[model samples]
Target chain A: MGVRGIEIKKKTTMENQLHIPTVAELMAKGESPEILFWVGCAGSFDERAQRITRDICKILAHVGLRYAILGTEENCTGDPAKRAGNEFLFQMQAMMNIEILNGYEIKKIVTACPHCFNTLKNEYPSLGGNYEVIHHTQLIQSLIDEGKLRPDDGHIFKGKKITYHDPCYLGRANDVYDAPREILESLDVQLTELKRCRSNGLCCGAGGAQMFKEPEKGNKDVNIERIEDVIESNAEIVAAACPFCMTMLRDGVKVKEKEQEIQVLDIAEITARANGL
Target chain B: MVSQFIFLGILTIALVLFGRNAKKIYNNIKLGKPTNRTDRKSERLKQMLLVAFGQKKMFKRPFPAILHALVYVGFCIINIEMLEIVIDGLFGTHRAFAFLGSFYSFLIYSFEWLALGVLLSCAVFLIRRNLGHIYRFQGRELTKWPKTDANLILIAEILLMSAFLTMNAADYKLQQIGAEHYIQAGAFPVSQYLTALLTDTQASLIFVERFCWWFHIIGVLAFLNYLPLSKHLHIMLAFPNTYFSNLEPKGKFKNIDSVTAEVKAMLDPSLPPPSGEVARFGVKDVQDLTWKNLLDAYTCTECGRCTAACPANITGKLLSPRKIMMDTRDRLEEVGNNRDKAGNIQDDGKSLIDNYITREEIWACTSCNACVEQCPVNIDPLQIIMGLRQYAVMEESQAPASINAMFSNMENNGAPWKYAQADRANWANPE
Candidate 1:
């Protein structure tokens, strides 16, 4: 049988379907989840990003890992406020979130957004909210390492050309460069790296709360400049880990009229599609 | 005896001037707010050694790194020769360390090679700055004074190295003819070749030898005093700046403690009220910054690597990280000078934010940490930009319209968008 057929046969043996449970719903049943999924504001509200969010949920369910989303209870992590220099607003949001997280006695958290991941992991501690935080890509890499999720079983992306755009917050800010690349590497795709990758990765122009505002007067939008790197990579599929990058890259591709030629997919979505979930 | 007195007098004047400049810089840095960079003793030391001493980060650009390493090593090794010159100048002796015999000769031989390296590297640097089309050196902020300042330092180094080599060559010629007090003490490798350029006559060689010797020493002293006023201060500040660099993750900006305290009080009414006088929200002037930020300004060599890597600046935005550091240093110097002249800091109807760094430049930053990552000495120009932004947002409430809308949405809707909190999890079951 083909790899896809074999994967389907193996999947049929497992009875658990893709069901996303809220932290509140799980708590009502007196059942605590193994992990709390922090769907950031972008992943929660952004249309393109919500697909990636659902894919992440699908992956968690496929792996049979008990993970619950904060759902309506989760608030913005105040990354934009902090970056925009609204320290008062940032601290207020941080205190509220810290209270909620500590009240739940939460120990582990995972998020798909680099901004949220960076803030929760790095900025939350000083405000008395400390959790064992991991990015969704990091979680995926670990799942692959544990042999729970097998990318080799899915041959959909066996030889497709893909490029991974390292989000500034994930790569340079937190030094989490390897996990996403490793997950991509496992997919058997022709991974082309941009000239600026890893610590030298260029920004998509949506960081520092710039996503919420129009860019200052410049010759070209920062996303368009970043798109030049994507075009130079000559990859058909551009893999992104951050929702902010997904939006910016999507816009850039559309502006360049290459949306028909290039596809911007988050790493979670790619992994879930590869698994035929 | 007359020459010795002149030498002593010049040395005393240079030392006194340099000491005063150092004190002024110290007090200016002290004008900044206090910060705790003293933690992580061993890590800081290691960082200083790796970055400043080893020039580790400079290797990111290999060609410039090589040239800079030559100049850096030459600058440091040549300073050892300065010790011998200082002793000879003070004691009216020739090659005072010549007592070490062959070891002194070995040191002089090494210094000659380094001097040659420095001379050539500086010449290349001058060409690269003025002639070569290096984008980093051609920023809008580098016009006029900044440009002249860089070229001037390079020319000075070239002149200083030439004077050193010519002194060695003339001394070699003097020793060959057995001129008085021109005792044969050290070996000359690079300078020995230059002996052909000197006149063979004894009196002329002596004149050339003495003239070059005096010029080299005076030039060295002048360079020492010039450091405080020039970007060359990086030579000294890079060490301490790297030592006191932010050790946390680049994404982890410092939380405003005053804001944190106020927020904590608001969240819990049972908690005691926040004490002390009301503090300003963000940096409006030099004094609002941390001592480390001030040190970063002084430590900046204006290489523009930060600007070159900046996505905003790369895409033609006004936000150049190098300019931020330059403006900070410039504004700090203005404040320091004002205090020096007026007996205390008198407001000159100017602040660092509006007077120097523009709101346009501050808002253009993407906060990507590329500048922070690209900085060789770990200067966090982003911190300064963020501080200025804080002042604009909280103190003045003059954020751009779009950003103001974002703030209101974040405050009211619990998100940057206008979506309701109730629908936040709608993505979980998105069709």
Candidate 2:
């Protein structure tokens, strides 16, 4: 394994003691975790996706579920490459990550980004990598259903005008529509619905590797159109499941000068806050 | 006999012209890179039947859908009559199918009704395009040649159908007067009504019938060849284009082969280091695209439904899915012309990116698949946009600054940020 060799170079920098253990660290102690938290590129680095990663981690921790992160060994699942039409770069990224993943004998994976969730669950199987991949919302929803975690009534989110924006990958691409909505329902918020929600949900303009590029010159920005749908719903808080949607919708809110009026938050962030984390 | 010989001469010229144009189009489409769309034969057949033959997607909008279906069915059924005219023109037989008697009358009656339907449908379509002020038609894409092309086809159809009715009406009048050589054959239920307006000179009626007959036939031949240049090519190519459409889950993207090989090598230490210069990823030029993409370009009806459905377009982004397909077709045509003259594609010092479709238009695509979903003929403009963006980012390194930051972050930190890999666990620890 390239683990020990690569670990030595960055080992000294791990001075801050975090509760999360790397997969290599766990396996070194001969412990096999039940699930691997596949914190995607966005979750690992993006400030917003990081918040989602932490909230999801808190939810798992609150339920006392066994999970570990790959840390240095993990890499992007190449969802961007496939979307950008650079299959070569995507394959290079996917094959290396798949090798590392399969080496650890990983079985179940949970991710925050719908892009990663889509790629890891659907696209990776054909390349000889397979795992039971679940989005964080689905995992958390199931946990709540199993009575592993409970939401208290009269919480901060109770009776709030919250509308959920479905991420394209999670909704249209994978048909995981109900899980996020079900999770939001637990918070006691008036679950308002956008006219274009669920299967007809409009994209937040971050899909198809569009997050990485300036939107093509067009009559209007897609995020603005998506945000307009949210505005029409007249919900005070715009709830989202995917980190990319969070970024795009947040930007759209700012563009419409509604950042103060409408709050953009991920399901995990809102859930973690609701649970008094 | 002399007239029959003259008809044969004219027919031969028309066939040669049509054949030459068809061959050029076939060659142009062949210039694209090959893709294997033959994997799912049954699915492709099913798709062709539903989308192309059944017009299932078109029915989403009731009014235009019905009119389009009428014109489509009329175009197909009217061609059956064209076959008869060809046989009669060749053998100099008057009403060559008259031998079928009542069955022939039924066919003629149906053709008359269809002819009327076709005429009315074409007129309505023309009105919708030129007068309706529909947003899809207002875009820059509909200007000049595209606009003229659509109107010209409708006008041509209207003229052709009118001539068919006039020829039949005059022939019916001539037959009623018991004129020389006016065969007492064929039903004229629709055109018989027109005979009420005819002047009683038998010679003038013969001239009108002959002129209308010649005009309709010549017009049909001219329209046949014009299809390769016009968006009306959808009339013929829709079947094969729909048949070859990508049947995979709409969001799935194909893995690049060389990238796969290189990655496989990286994973297996026993495999020797990969050799040979790697090919550029994604599409930048006409030849880089799959042939099915070229077929899509040629098959586009420019109906602009895709543009109308596009979120980016609706929000006032420069991206129009219809424009993407049109630009691809236009660039393909330019490439075809270049290839024809140069014997092979050489750098014309231009490509689809800057020379035809702009980088702004390519980048504007949100990849929402709304355009793909809205396409009546199953043309996936998002695929072309993705291909171009791939070329822009990987090959040219022309990705916007923000994307560059994301890419760099991923390359250095195993994620799309400047944070160190070890700090990833810090999200768990919090501040």
Chain B TM per candidate, please? 0.98, 0.95
DockQ each:
0.80, 0.37
The regions of model 2 sitting more than 4 angstroms off are A1-35, A45-73, A81-89, A132-166, A171-201, A213-220, A233-239, A257-277, B99-102, B174-193, B263-270
DockQ of 1: 0.80
lDDT score, candidate 2, position B89: 85
User: How far is B200's C-alpha from truth in model 2 (Å)?
Assistant: 3.9
Q: Rate the local accuracy (lDDT) of all candidates.
A: 0.90, 0.82
The global Cα lDDT (0 to 1) of model 2 is: 0.82
Best by lDDT: 1
